[model samples]
Target: MNWRKRFRTFWNRYASQVLRKILPRLESMAARLSSTDDTQELSEILATYKMSGFPLPMSFTDVDTVIENALSTGVHLTEAKNAEFALAVHIHPYPSNVLAVWVYVAVLSRKS
Candidate 1:
C-alpha cells in the first residue's frame, strides 16, 4: 500500500474512535451554542480534545489556531440546526486551491 492509503486507513480508525468518545458532548454543545455563533467556545472544546492527546494531523497545532486560519482563508459553517462540526484543510494552492473538507451533520428529533 502507498503512504496515502496507509494514512487514510489510520485516519479512518482514529477519527471513528474520536467521534465515539466526543459525539455526545458535541451534541450538547451544539444545542447550547445553537442560539449564538460561538466559534471560540466550540474551538475550546476541540482544543481540550487535542490537549487530551488526540492532536489533529499536521504538526501539533491547537484546534483554535487551525480554525482561525481556516476562517481567515475562507471557510463556511451553515446555520442549519443539523450542522454539527466541520474540518477543512488546504492541500494545494496553485491556480486553484484544493480543500479537503468534511462536515458531520446529524439530526436529532424525538418522536412524540
Candidate 2:
C-alpha cells in the first residue's frame, strides 16, 4: 500500500488515542496566546508532536497544498485558507445530513 493508505490505516486505528493527547494541549496553548504572536508557539506544538513520535502529516505544508487538498476532497469548503491552520468546513449538501458539521482542518507543518 502507498504511504497515504498506510497512514490512513494507522490514523483510523490510532487517531483518537493521539488526539486525546494533542487537542487539549493545543486548546490550552491557543487560549493562553490570547492576542500575541502564535507562530513560535504553534511551531513548538508541532515539534512536540514530532518528538512524541506522533508527528502530523506534512502534506499540507503550504497554502497551495492546503488549497489543493481541500479542493480534492470533493466536499466544497465554506472558506479559503488564511493561516497555518485552516479549517475547511464541509457541510453536507444533501438534505438528510444538512445539519451535520464535518470539519476538515489541516495543520500546516514546516516539515518537508
Using lDDT, give the best candidate's number. 2
lDDT tens digits, residue span 1-112, model 2: 1323212211221323333444444434434633444345446546533311222222223455645654565322223232133342322233544332233444332343
Candidate 1 global CA lDDT score = 0.33
Model 2, which residues run further than 4 Å from truth? 1-11, 33-112
Clashes of 2: 0
TM-score quality measure for candidate 2: 0.23
Count clashing residue pairs per candidate. Answer: 0, 0
Clashing pairs in 1: none
> Cα lDDT of all candidates, in order?
0.33, 0.36
